[model samples]
Target: MGEVNRRRFLERMTALTATAVATPATLGAIANAGSRFPGETRAGSRAAAGRPDELKLPPAGRPQPAELTELTLAEAARLLRDGDVGAVELVEAYLARIGRWDARYQAFNTVVSRDALEAARTADRTRGRAPLTGVPLAIKDNYFTAGVRTTANSFIFEDFVPDFDATSWARLRDAGAILLGKTQMGPLATTAASTPTGERTTANAWAPHHDDVSPGGSSSGSATAVAARMAASSTGTQTGGSITNPSNAQGLTGIKPTMGRVSLHGILPLTYTRDHPGPLARDAVDAALMLQIMAGPDPADPRSLGLPPVPDYLGAVREDAGALTHPERGGAVRIGVLPGFLDEPEPPEDPAPDPDPDIDRIGSSFPRRERTQAAYRREVATVEARRRMLATLEEMGAEIVALDFPTHWEALTSFNFNNVRLPERSEIFLEHLRDDVRKFGVSLAPWINGLLLPAAEYVRGSRARLVLLREVLDEVFARCDLVTQTAPFPFDMVGLPLIGFPIGFETGSTGYPRPIGGMFGAEPYAEHHLLAVIAAYQRATDWHLRRPADPGELRPAEGNGGGPRGGAGGSAGRDRSPGRYDLFDVMERGE
Candidate 1:
């Protein structure tokens, strides 16, 4: 490890040790119980100590009414401007909701109750109801906050409170957004795992009630909190799939801004090159409002230099609705559909029921029969859904054309490799691994080394990947005004806007939980235009507003279990194929 990374790792280890010591015995007892707040009782059941079913349910009743729910940032701003609501009331409402639901969902690590209320009061008093003034927002734990513990979900930094706010945090505060608390994030934001150190793994709001299922990584808590309405919206940082994937799972709208659009200074680094901080909210309008307050160049972050001015993102939403028509309106809306992205070779059948006694013993609990039938049904349903979505878009006046990029497959490889070199991972291992390496086991040593070595390789190859991605993106742009595919898989599952660049296959590798989808983007500062297109689609259709029925209300029909396919594990890739598109036909046409 490099000298700098070695130092960082050591610091983190020291922090982790401190955290271990500081945690009360009671905390450790309940840590695995998946309860975040202490002294809170399970909502519907008596505590059974170690039983998972005894965990609390967040306070009930949708905090935001359907009419008030999914309010765009612009609309909220206008309300604040018009004195429709007070900042204090809004902050109080969100806090009350958090107080009730946060324990069950384990979404936040810290609640800045005093700080948030004070900030809201200041906004109401001074800003006199500006757009974001008094808006309650959650900061991802990685961001620095003065006088608050910014642990980055690592034990090593448990007591290491920063003396300064991250540039982004400071900006949000300045914009009059109240900081509710620090939301949990994956440990060091390295692995895609949802469970970060010191916090429970967040569960998908749409998934059956269980903690083991994937909540879509790194930004898991942020997405979950927003989905469950613990907070109106929250901040998340993405290095690859972090933001978008969680947003997909939680059914929230998220933006992965082009690199350099948001400042990273004061925020913990992952891959400095790839890490992007963005908003996860209920819909596109809310996301746009948050983006307006957060986007800008920061002198503290050298990467943000030479960036152009951020346009009024809210204006783009208006433009999409024909509120601001320009000469470009006469141009046909040409959208490219990359059909090759939908194809995936089936996994070789599970080694024919491993006949060995040992294999049988290990797999005894596996529900083979029911899981198989459920998987088959889900595959059929997913295929039909995608077909309907595409048909619906075409029916809505979108001119769809086949837009193929055979090289798009390279993105998955590139992103996987890029993840290793992230500074956060390297720094953690470099500083902390020497003494603890033996304790973590031989397997982890190689994995840590894999992270380090491949990170070096990724940095070396990034230039090439960027060149290839830019070339492919340019080609698509040349042929059509926009490129559309099944918006990221999680978006449909969670029900949010699909407005970003596509970077991975919609059908993920075998054994993985969910299929991934890529997004489209324009030049650096041009994300606004891309967002506008998404907003246009949303305006033309109510798809983004469709919320799944509450899990408690769902009932199974006569022959079927109303439970999610794959139970929790099976749900991962059960819906891989688009319900609408036929893989065989797309492949045959390509051939």
Candidate 2:
């Protein structure tokens, strides 16, 4: 066969078996969803009435809301446990901030102020040492929150309120974390936060004034909520880089734990094997704590069963990776770098112009040209930043190794997505597709395309996936403990764990600084490895510590404060009456 035909033949073969392996898992999940998983009865009870953890109390003193809001999750937990800050006060502080700024950012689709405050009150009154006691979190809209409107930011689910909490949220609530609200998301978690008509809803916290900037898709509002300090940290789910992309865009730390590390029982599923529910936090340590609480086996998700016990994430993060030797690697954390990922080749001189028909379609592609140039510059800067970060990691005793995967990265990722991911997503949403495809909005075409895929190709793709997974395990992972690259598809395809964190920043054309992010992928069930390395990097660098400028920093002209209320423990305003806490009313009043 000719070279092209040979390649085509292989592609055909690979696509045929894409869905064969995943069918059993999907059916098992559906079967088990109705029954309570082990300890689920206990989880359900805890979810109904949250229990707070007890710790040694320090002398009490009232801390300003702004000061309380500024502290990290770990810091805030210490304050809550030490009795220095009341849970009510902490929740009130975040609620006030959200009420003040969220109107402009549109980070939340629903802010459960009354519910959150009540939960906070419970946290204050109750006692025990669970990790997240009294911590406030912005949950992604896709996650089911019993009685709360769980719209997945879609018109189809606009009025839908789930009767049961998602397993991830239930775990957090049971551990004493207060639900701040449901952050806005891409309609059905398929694109950036936008209406069915494609009108943007959420704004990038770093550049809210610029309509051109993206907060990143699907998990956009989750990242915005954290970046704007509207909530301490937030939950995010990734089917295809949803968690990491937004976290990178907003300069936060996001971990897409191994697919089954956390159960996806109540999350709106995009793909059975690729959907990973995890945390977008201020830093790696915060991410670790949240993941620790979120990770565990659940009978509702058969994929989560048969896994080893969740590791000591906090302990792993606390260990100085720089100082301690990795037993297996025989050195510090072995980070594998793909030179192509970090080094961008120069654009070809005298590039071919757009075809004549293209020019006729759009008179001037200046907008396209401008976008391309800006992206090129951003990537250039990102390359530089990543190279610098590698140097820094080496200085901190990490061993950087150049490595390459066995399969063609681009080819394999495209095959996996088109053949495997699309089919699974289509299967999950087949009822919607058959009924009213128009409701899918920006994702309608993609959903339709999935329906058009040949069954033989999908089965072939599944067979190829098994081959790729074995190759990755035997070849790629054998060389390094972690791969230092941000493209999540390759790892997400194989169900491996990865972490995305801020490495540096570059000022955009709008003069607003945007963050540049780096990621490291680890072997399956090895989230602790990913977390430890990132925590060490965070400890050494302050990129993750940077906060976005609040668009609503200055209150209305009639308001008392002229500057940001977030600084120096200053009061933004006193808490309003319980009746006045409704976000819709607050936004309508234009306050």
Candidate 3:
């Protein structure tokens, strides 16, 4: 077969693999709708509550135990294993914290109190066993969990529940991990903007500074929950930038394991070619541990290729610490700095406003020149940051070499198009436009429906674009151990780890809704190990340790200069039921 045919064949295989991996719940919804679901439709329960504007901020009070909340997943596991804390106690602590805070922040859509307690009970039964036994976790709503309402933050699947656990969820559960319930996610896990605009726009735990800004989509809830200490760790998925972006925005550590590192079975799909499942946590060690459990092949998922014997991520974490401490052992690590990736070109000085034919057709005009200038300024900032980051690494005794990939700029746009075009527009047509347009006169019907034709065309265009981008990336990765670039601004400002934030500095004003970052991936499987390295760096550094400015507060004592008469010692009343309940239940008549 010719190269084009070969690529087409591979793409088709990937799409088939994706279709095969989706759970029956998701496939059933698609069959009923006559089209695949959009990210918006599968959105978690939080999105079902309302749009972003309707979300009310959680009431402010004294800061909750941010430090305790920020413990790494591994540390939490050790504490549980050592009897320093019981599973039930840990669950209750987080439950109380969520009650005290999540409403304002909208970090979770559903809290499985019964399931959590049962899991905790199971953990207690298995006391003194299982590395992660009894440890609480939050799964992004996109992952399938049997009998749980796994909404993708969309109305289409608002009532859909899966009958089986996603591969990673099953592994974690088997490992004695307790599920705290499904966290919120972007509407269908589409654009990064979805992260901040879902049913309950998840506020950056490090917000006001990071809130208001996009929380990084698709995995927003997962990142926010981990950051806010709602869960010791959480699972997140990425098609383009979901996991890493939210991780960056929330100042947590995230890994986007290479395409097949973890089974994609039982998750909602954006694109089959790029979808990956990984972990988001307070630090690298926790992420690594989760990755170890989640990694490995599954016969159920055709795309699951056997990973070369999985290493002890905790061991890798230890190795990273040793590498940092022993410069002689680390020996001038060669980091390739992608300068072209850094020097994002500003659009022309006198660019036409509303240059896009689509925008012009809509009679909307954008400030083209101002947008160009803004792009230039943002690129300048990105380059400067890249330089500083290199300096920081060099100060730590690493060698930095400048590398260039002129084609990298095109890669981001290409990836973005592929990420959204087909799935997004397909749902928009079927859900919103088709029926309405079909009601028009027969003669006008075709013309009106023609507007929806772009969706299919865009999908085809995206396939071509992906081919080009993938080829370019493959070439760039051939010579570099790792290509380093500034972590995106939205994430950098919040002090999140960048190990996997993509390169480039596209401006939101320049039609990109978020600050794009550079990436370092070589060959098809390079992102896998590169991300591991990024996790390792974070494991060795304090960069991901930064906390939010106002992590919200704990409700004060009633008698001591506080509102409403309550108990002292911050002990919010506890119900000893085997089942867990939130403040909402306490406030409401329901138990």
Candidate 4:
């Protein structure tokens, strides 16, 4: 798309998402429709809660030209610390890249060019206290940035700027990380929506003609930016599958730290118990680098359980891929697998398979035109990815064991218990908006206007959630180190640490190949174990590094402004770099 089209696309997205149902007639009618449900007290709950279009801040201060966009966050840090690259140079590389490419991808919300460059300049003067200090990163709109407008991708607070930073963000900011911009996201973190505005026609990073797919949200832009290499790393928040889904779709590793592992203060609320603020990065190590800074105590947030002793996540996820050598990968901790899951699809085994998207959801085209053998192949390919992962684990000497599927998965999946908490959320919104509640995002009106629920239902759902969190975990972890699953939402429901990583890619109608990811869940607070397994698998695989072929290989759009994809004239295609993908193959042959 050309510059004008790009500009229009962004403008339209902002207008649509900011389209609030704040008409006086609508507000008055919704207000009068009060308490529709048995226990919901919209006014009483005056409490609750709260991306797709990425808006770029106007360009400002000069950037230092440096050929350093694709370096892993760790590699970039090493260069920064060794004085091989100045912070300003690295910052310019990213800003220059974002300027050229983001229009094609629409992955960011607000690009803080002026502030980011200034921060980079400052980092250049100071000695680093952390590895993440000199990196450029993006934050989802849900996290507050003092003085920056954090709309949460809603019309409600589109004009609302915060005077404080969310704890997770504060830590990163203090660490010397530069904020490239906020990412585009779903309205109120609700769905997987597109970019904030422009680049509507950019082909899938995998295929050009076929671009129809959920970029995945509510962390859509964060994933896209990182995958597209717009930023070194970005922040993603997950109340349900936000972090993992986007990570899976974009071929990135997203770690949803255990609840309370990271602080929540100064951020919008989704569910009191389920909200998770974490990092999305190109690899597990980059993710670990970010988590090291985010996973600690916050005096501001009571929920920030203050990690008693911070673990060296970076040390755990290393290039050495040594986690596979740990005896726990074999004898000490059992690899949890549901009986017969790997064997065949027989009905009797009764399993709580992790969160895999519905097959219909994975299908690419619209309408029941036809189901060719090609479609069937795509489905089979996804399943095969899972089997390959199982085989790899066995090769590494891990002991796979059968465990009864947890009962909670059924209810947790079928009926999101978090639904009962809706009234509370709406209440919080109204409270936050106060007189301006009507002035808030009007799109929310359809969901909350006159909405109420039976207090008893809310209570029952909360109670059921408690029971599931307590009882199911006690049983599952007693028998295994972590459970294998599709999406890991069951774990999210009860506030457990869960992760999802790409195993391979699957071809579909959208011309672009879809990512095939496997999900894993650890007992609560066992993120280290989760990270270890991810690090090992990634060290042995190349799928995560594979970038799509047609759409993005450093070529700027036909008639756009940005110079090239990486500025250094580099192609992101991992397939071209034989050594990278061959790492695991070489190891396999030697063994």
- TM per candidate comes to 0.68, 0.80, 0.65, 0.73
lDDT tens per residue, model 1, 306-383 = 756665455555432342122144554556667653344243354423333333211213112223434443344445
Give each model's whole-structure lDDT.
0.51, 0.69, 0.52, 0.61
Predict model 1's lDDT versus the native: 0.51
Q: Of models 1 and 2, which has the larger TM-score?
A: 2
Best by lDDT: 2
- Candidate 3, residue 322: the lDDT equals 37
* Sort by TM-score, top down from the best: 2, 4, 1, 3
**Model 3, range 323-415, lDDT digits (tens) per residue?**
223222344555676656446565556652443433322112211222454446666766764555556656765566666644544433332
Best model per TM-score: 2
Residue-wise C-alpha lDDT for candidate 4, range 399-487, written one tens digit per residue: 67778767665665443354554565666666654655544332343235214666787678777877787666676777778678654
Off by over 4 Å in 2: 1-63, 319-324, 327-330, 345-371, 415-419, 552-591
Off by over 4 Å in 1: 1-73, 191-200, 319-330, 341-383, 406-424, 427-429, 435-447, 450-460, 484-523, 547-591
Give the count of colliding residue pairs in each prediction: 32, 21, 24, 34
State each model's C-alpha RMSD to the native.
17.2, 14.3, 17.2, 16.6
lDDT of 1 at 428: 45
